[model samples]
Target: MNTISYRWMTSLVFVLFAGLLGAWSAADASELPALNITQVSENVFSAIGATAAPSRDNFGHNNNLSFVITEGGVVVVNGGDNVLLAAALHRAIEERTDKPVRYVINENGQGHAFLGNSYWSDLGVTIIAQREAIEEIKAHGEASLSQMRARMGPVVTDARVVVPDVAVDDHYVLELASEPIELRRFGAAHSPGDLSVWLPKQRILIAGDIAFHERLLGIFPDSDVDAWIDSFDVMASLNPVVVIPGHGHPTDIETLRYFTQGYLQFLRDEIEVILDDDGGLSDAYEIDQSAYESLDTFDELARKNAGRLFRQMEEKLFQ
Candidate 1:
């Protein structure tokens, strides 16, 4: 088999094995919530998180937590949403290899991305994030902790706001591993300081919140849809053979394009039509998002996303 097909089949086999093991795997003996781990490549693995909103059941694990085992050590992506989840992920890593976790890279400053830094920080793991992400964490980390506490209660009692040890501007090449991992921030995306972890040698991209496959991408108050499209285009230019997204299972670039950029463009196009016709925000909300109705979180975010984009477009038009 070709190299690409071999890697894909290997990953598929691991996924099927994980599925057969069920949601709560052997890691449950550690008394922590077990993540569904999927092998992406030879040394790369990802713990797929729940697609639903953060809650007591999922322990605020609403985003993917991934890791790469390298000759130097293991590098983790997304500290997880809280201490327990991070600890749980660590336990799973231990089960795989004996390499110590050398670094934890936060994809962004969002709670699900960096809140678990408390766990890694306590262990003296070097943490890394984009400069803007560090600033976002410094400014809003406490608020994110409070929100997780409210949603998860005692589960997040040990969770605290912890910033990264290293902050890079737009690009940072992490070389501790045999296969150097490149962390790059294209621009404004799903959230501030969003970045993707690119394994050039493997042609696999761990796209943080920049790409969403199974779920509907959220448009936050600060999100710039226009810039997001531009950023997605830049990231897509890499032609990744495999894509591990922030909130879904390991997928391909085409799937991300269909669900993320395609969805955003569809909403923006619909909103532009409404604005040109002198329609109101309510009309924007009623735009046909049925095509995306099958996606996770569509019920919770579809109309809200449309309304937010409408306001954003309207503000830009008047500006």
Candidate 2:
């Protein structure tokens, strides 16, 4: 409802600056081995896969993540980056159970979500993404796929990308294999439409791109800052015991809050600093990531947190 503002634009520009810094700081020198999946619940799971680019300290190909294997057929959330990752996810789920993948829901319309959808859909899985996601794909799908093809090189040569078949507006609840899953709209946070998959019985929340455990967050200029914060509060209210983030390992409700509050608060503080110093938003874009020089990466998530916050504040012109 709130129209874009220069204040918000400043915020987004900062985020883009930070995303670039995070990428720079990343020391991915080698590709990591494939990710391995381990069961965390009776029928619930999460996995730490290959590093994102390899050679990066602690920054692996985490997008190579997912959950699945419901007797109601396999219901997955988030369709990673490439066919290899998708195939890896399929194989990982296969290790747990042979159930066919029935549905896949993309929380946001990132290249990661759209890239691997074709593999699952080829296997007959119904792809479900937000209506905005469908539009986003149409808008950027080919361009995104082009990037994916470049990244994956030969693997994506013939990628039969699967587009979403189910486009949701607000929210959706399904009775599947006796398990009820609630896909609720968190308004516009990371994107104009971001949906979180809440498994009531399991008390698990699969927050797509809205929440990051300890990774750099890429804030699309399209996101609403106030609404994003509010949505965070909404997600925190759910009190999920186990939260499955779009990236990063499984976490709890408090962790999600740390992302929304702690991270966002940090961005707000730094943005204020830049504003006070008359440091143009573009300046924030070129901030020396050394601002995190004193912070220890292992001791806390401050560096990545700062990077994400920087990204949110630096890129606000997204449609």
Candidate 3:
């Protein structure tokens, strides 16, 4: 063949090979469940989760997973509920940027927030959480793994408890790229070690479980209602322009306040009235929560929240 013909053949072969490689990469990245990603700011993105309780259908993903892209690398918030879910989130991140995930931040010690650390750990990514959260994981990580396995079946079979590599007491900062990511633990909130990721330059806050907008926040046995209120006040003082809550879409401060702090205060007030009348736990459950009835998981959490708050208040009053 002439030199021109030979060169033309080589160029055609290279183009075909490149096309095939691209197709395979795209398919591999899409193998997991598609995350509902919303770009909240120029470099920050949020994968909003279901507002309902964790279930097999949702693959135990009932909490938000977010990430911020920086010049250095990507920082992921919430390791995710299980290995599969974490892998899914990583795939979504891959689709958006080529930067490696340098850090995985657990907003709290909840299973959905940190159980997927196993996946990140395998990748050798550094995991960070508040000191209390690290302690919570050390105490309850195995139990959380069991719970996930029970609820999600084989979907979570590969998940293992991997404690964070870095534990910050109150505040830690990641000066990656042009944006500075600040992790702050105000105080007790929805659960142990609940923290928020603040981007001062962007005026955006990844409020984690510290702020809930569309859903009624679950008051677990460990949840400190009064302290949660105080923590909310401190977090609100940040005056974030956008908040990516733990269980809802990205929203404003007012919406987060109305649903999280407002709901907690409303419940506290009602429980106080019950206590004033010498009411019992049953009476606490009967208190009106009509205003927050529209929130997702209201049926599952409202009465439980009221009863828990009543018990907490009772103990405080008698102590």
Candidate 4:
């Protein structure tokens, strides 16, 4: 670990927290400041959505994040870049219970999922995540944080990126907080491997990137759109009543299919547009964004699902 300047850290925290207690905006709705957390159901908790992504924070919707306060301890799903959000979550957990958080879970390998891991790991909390997430962080965490320092700021880089203490090869079902928890690994969709934290006791599903509320899901360098669409079916299989998305607000099982259909269809349309335009791959990407900006933010995820969607479109066109 590299040593950081304390003065820089203090200044950075202040700059990053300027809006911590302010009003909300749709864009700012993506942050997980402690104030956002709300006890939605019995023993089920989440940091409500906030507007804007933080200066150093990379992912847009670490928002709508949550933790499960089991009788034994609290289990945090996504750590939100690092300790600031993680500590905020820890504060929220304290409000609901005196139980120590025994487990930290990641729904996906995104920075939002694993970056804040140091907080729990330091406290001897067992970190749980998919095999792929562990590998990705090990491969890229440091470099990513270094590059993101300016935008997301110094605290993110100051915090150590952690790997999963427990790696699941396939789906794993276990008990936590005296409740039956289903850690379902539904193949590759949003990333190499995605885990859906299911609380059978509460009938709540933490549907990471598998579903989003009124926003375009990001299909990154590792994402598979078709497989991502299929993952939605997997999310639906549980027939969850209340869902905690990786971003935005809570949603239901019904919206998963609705959003998936729109996402998949939009990809198909872009593929057709790319072929008809007879343009190069890059051109198709640009064209798709201009044409589809009106679709939905989910369609505009990373502002470049357009390119990924276009690449998939081009592949299908050639095939």
Candidate 5:
């Protein structure tokens, strides 16, 4: 582990210890999810999302938002689901640092990732993402925003769709606020253009939707189970000390191994067994998933994940 400077460490400690007391106070006065900042490292802080579904009570802020303070300024990981939620996150970061937000990364192609772009755009902060993410937003951003507005109502007010300012086809590395940030795309996992933000020096990983902790990893129409599994291997290779997943609290790699990677592997193994037995999607869904039953959104996503994995595995068999 890299040794952190004493002064910097003290600042981090202050942020970690003192930040919590003032964390929830910075969010908007409206009914948005209360944002709390936790100092994960000397330079890293995160506003964890609700592990449960977005309701009028939580205001669709059920996604993680993180910021890394660099010597130059701050680099935000993922923007929140809507404008107001993003505004609340902005307030939290503002409370901690006087430096500007130098960069904002919409980690994946999901609508929630990019919908908050307008808020940052007005401040002249450069938004970055994978080319595939830009494409995904262009194709589905409006519809997704409309659906989210209808579902969350006032929480997403003033939320407008904005494409990233900078889009890259592969890895993009640069020095932001005097700190190095490597943005990598590990093929399709959660979506066609999922991205992971790696701080090489800190060994901190902001692992978008590619890894979910307690919450059930989603399997959307654009998701690929096989690729998602491969991406887990890629994440493990980084050996991140702290991982900020898309929808859960920050966790260690070991917890992630068992909860995220292990659970996915178990599902694939079970689905393969069902396929080997000449079973179908229904049978795959019938497999004992009691282990993950207590996880948030298991009821909403587990069977669907099973069905998706089964279809993918079956398709691969023929190919």
Candidate 6:
């Protein structure tokens, strides 16, 4: 397995392109939304999103988006939260290289996964996702879009749901212009159609929402907590050098295992302990979370994640 270093490398392309692009365009890359696009590898750049939720302030760019610049073209992971943000990503790409975006992979059926479809589609890019995710978008995508519109207000007006052209189930591989890319799904983990984009040569695994760094996982009603645990094992099995989380920072498999995977396991164990002790679901609030207390959104998400997992465990055990 190749070891991936998380250190930032100075991108001559980024600096050179930004300089040339600055003279040609009025909008500065820095003037765009709060996203900080940095070159994490030779051909890989990550637009690490904000820790906070989508709002008019941040323009709904709260999910990570990674673009791989290959000789053929570019492949983007996670469409982004809305059109405005996606357009910003488009410009960001323009600042880096002139390669057209060939494909956009929806990591899941979530709002951030496909909301930016229109922008990419307008440019003739084909979107791809797991078959289950396509079904999810068909079922609940409209309602999710409505909720996002209300939360984000005017920023999401242009956002539209565009389903992927290609539907992948277990695994799919693409030989892009420069490298071979692998798309693997870990059976209904974070979302029903959770997909991880892996670049074997780069040893980078874009762990969509399946792995989060120093943040609480959103346990949506349909989410399977047990399956999510198993999915973490699957992610670790890849031994990825760099794991670009669905949210938060790009990190290593160890951090993903301990912080993201370990935290989920800890939540399940604590909830189970409360249940085994004849304590009600409310008792999960008393579990010590001092270790993950400093993590982002810990206060807002910790209790909610605990309650959701407790209820799920209760149903599985009692039923």
Backbone N/Cα/C clashes per model:
0, 26, 0, 21, 1, 1
lDDT, residue 180, model 1? 96
Model with the higher TM-score, candidate 3 or 5: 3
Instruction: List runs of model 6 lying over 4 Å from the truth.
Output: 1-34
lDDT of 5 at 257: 74
| TM-score winner | 1
Local error of candidate 1 at residue 253 (angstroms): 0.6
The TM-score, computed over Cα atoms with residue i paired to residue i, of candidate 5 is 0.87
Prediction 5 global C-alpha lDDT? 0.78
Q: Report the C-alpha lDDT of model 1 over 255-299, residue by residue, as the tens digit.
A: 999999999999999999999999999999899999999999999
lDDT of each: 0.86, 0.64, 0.84, 0.66, 0.78, 0.79
Give candidate 2's whole-model lDDT: 0.64
Q: Which prediction has the highest lDDT against the true structure?
A: 1
Q: Which residue pairs in candidate 6 have backbone atoms (N, alpha carbon, C) closer than 3 angstroms, thus clashing? A: 72-177
Deviation (Å) of 28 in candidate 4 = 22
List the candidate 4 regions with Cα displacement exceeding 4 Å.
Answer: 1-33, 56-61, 152-157, 276-303, 316-319
Q: Write the per-residue lDDT of candidate 6 for residues 1-319, one digit (tens) a residue.
A: 1112111112343344445433214334455575699787988988988787777677677888899998877899988877667768877887887666789999999888888776676556889999999999999889878987787664345456787899999899978866999999876677789998998887898889988876766777788878888888877887888889998888888877887778888888888778888999769867787898877888888788887878888888889
TM-score of each: 0.90, 0.75, 0.89, 0.79, 0.87, 0.88
Q: What's the best-to-worst order under TM-score?
A: 1, 3, 6, 5, 4, 2
**Residue-level lDDT for 221 in candidate 2:** 53
lDDT of 4 at 25: 28
C-alpha RMSD in Å of predicted model 6 compared with the true structure: 7.6
Please list the residue runs of candidate 3 whose C-alpha ends up more than 4 Å from where it truly belongs after superposition: 1-31
lDDT of 1 at 275: 96
lDDT of 4 by residue, 91-143 (tens): 66766776666678877676767776776666567888888888887888787
lDDT of 1: 0.86
lDDT of 6 at 253: 85
